[model samples]
Target: MFCLPVAGIGASAYRGWPTRTGDIEICPIQLPGRENRFRAPAHTSMDAFVKDAADALQPYLDKPFGFFGHCFGARLSYGLSVELAARGGPLPQRIFASSCLAPHRGGYFGGGRSGPFTPETTDEEYMEELRHGCELRGEPTPPDELLGLSIQVLRADIALTCGYRPPGPGGTPLNVTTISWTGDTHMRPEEMDEWSAYGDVHQVLLTGDDFTHRSAPADLLQVIADGLPERTGVLTP
Candidate 1:
């Protein structure tokens, strides 16, 4: 499976996840502009980033792989899955979108600015955003240079998500199994139900907040294992 990271983070965002789970091999997506890719420019839009992701993940799709993402990353994974299908390539057998609502619903991180973050966002406003991010991450606000970098990448990601446009009325639903996992404290049941518009949806309401994917990976793993196809006696990996 492939795991995508939330805003202001890279592949290391999933550092807490177990290396191996049953037949599942957790391969995390390392987006540009963070961690080892710090020198690279961050993607400013979800559409563009997903296209790049699809191209980059082509080789690994040979097996019955899956996509998993948390919060902002969930949106990215969903977009990538769509991109892969559109490009006539392999599609994920199941999609696990955690701690987020469907694409059509805008996120809490973005405050009206659906475009790139510029000198436009005042210092105070940006700080507020950072504080909000800290809350979601369940961490103290970063300081100095680290804060600056986090704001940059996070704003870009928020812009992408806030500006996302769902298919118009009557648009066809995605032909894949989608699992929406939202924390009981983080999102309301009504919000999680919105995912049904995406496809055949299964909802799992767990006990925790937005950071549950990191805080309780073992529980998440069990949920994933249950959803995975049963080859019965054999473990593929």
Candidate 2:
């Protein structure tokens, strides 16, 4: 499984993920401007994100593999899959999109931006969000660990998410599985239907399960395993 990182999550997020590197390998898609790889500025657009991500992950495309992405990462996986197909390369055998709604759902989350954030907010708000700090009252405070780590990468990612107005409709010519919290605030149950545009869409509802796949490793493993036949028959070494 090629694990794509969610917004504010780095490749290191998969560290000690309760599994071995043989049966399944999690390749955390390292976006530019994140984690230890941070040295350059970040892009605020989806297209730019795809271009940079594809380039960075080019070396890993030596074989076909299952792609897994949650929330922001899900969008990246779809984009990467499409881009590779467009370029006549080894396409992804299966794409697991989690936590996010359909790409074409305009007005998602009450539509439009929620107005500007206070300037008091850090320049990199995405980084600030994942800060391991406990909130006292409603104000955000950064923890020592987060402060020590470079967060500009996360901030840039939020800028991209905020600025995005998903273009066109959802339709990827690839096999896909959609997983979401049945009661998730961000994803609507109806939105899962939109995934049919991508061909062979399987929707998994974690009715009471939390966001973390670790919450149900057995189930996640089954989904990954079910994908193998399609992958084995279709994807080359």
Candidate 3:
């Protein structure tokens, strides 16, 4: 499975995940402007990002694979799948969307808010918000220098999310598994039912807080293992 990180963070977030979870191999995608890709400019357009990501993933598309994304990453997973299908490229067998509302819900942030912050938002405000978010996730805030860089990447990511427009009415549907954490305050499990519009959504509720996914618990792995096939096979062109 390809693991996409949450907003404002890097692929390193999944560093704790075992290299292989059951029959699934964990592959974490590294978006630009964060971690090792810090020098690369962050993408502010969903279409552009998806196109580039599809191109970059060509070699790995030979075998059956799936996507696992949390929060903003969830949106990217869905977008990539749609884009690949449009291009007649290989598609994922399943999509694991955790802690995110369906695209048609029409809101970047929870509670139908268009966006939480804008380019006009002051650095101090962004810092405070980031700190608060870390607190909520039970993690320590990054140092000032790192936080400053994170803010830049986050701003670009937020712009990408805000600018995205979901498909109208009936969009293409795929096999998807929507995951919700019992303690997730950001996106409640009950609010994610709209995902059914996108595909055969199998709703899964895990017992943990929002950041629990970072730990890659047994239950979460088991859920993922259950959704995937026991053997990997090549995708027919």
Identify the leading candidate in terms of lDDT.
3
Model 1 has an lDDT value of: 0.69
Model 3 lDDT tens row, 40-97: 9999989989999999898889888989999899999988988998999688888999
RMSD to truth, every model: 4.2, 5.0, 2.8
Candidate 3 collision pairs: none
Clashing residue pairs in candidate 2 are: none
Using lDDT as the measure, name the better of candidate 1 and candidate 2: 1
Which segments of candidate 2 are over 4 A away from where they belong? 19-22, 106-151, 162-171, 207-210, 214-216, 230-237
lDDT by residue (tens digit), candidate 1, 82-107: 77867886777677888666676664
Rank the models by lDDT, top first.
3, 1, 2
User: Could you estimate the TM-score for every candidate?
Assistant: 0.81, 0.74, 0.91
Clashes of each: 0, 0, 0
Report, for every candidate in turn, its global Cα lDDT versus the true structure: 0.69, 0.61, 0.84
Query: What value does the lDDT take at residue 39 in candidate 2?
Result: 66
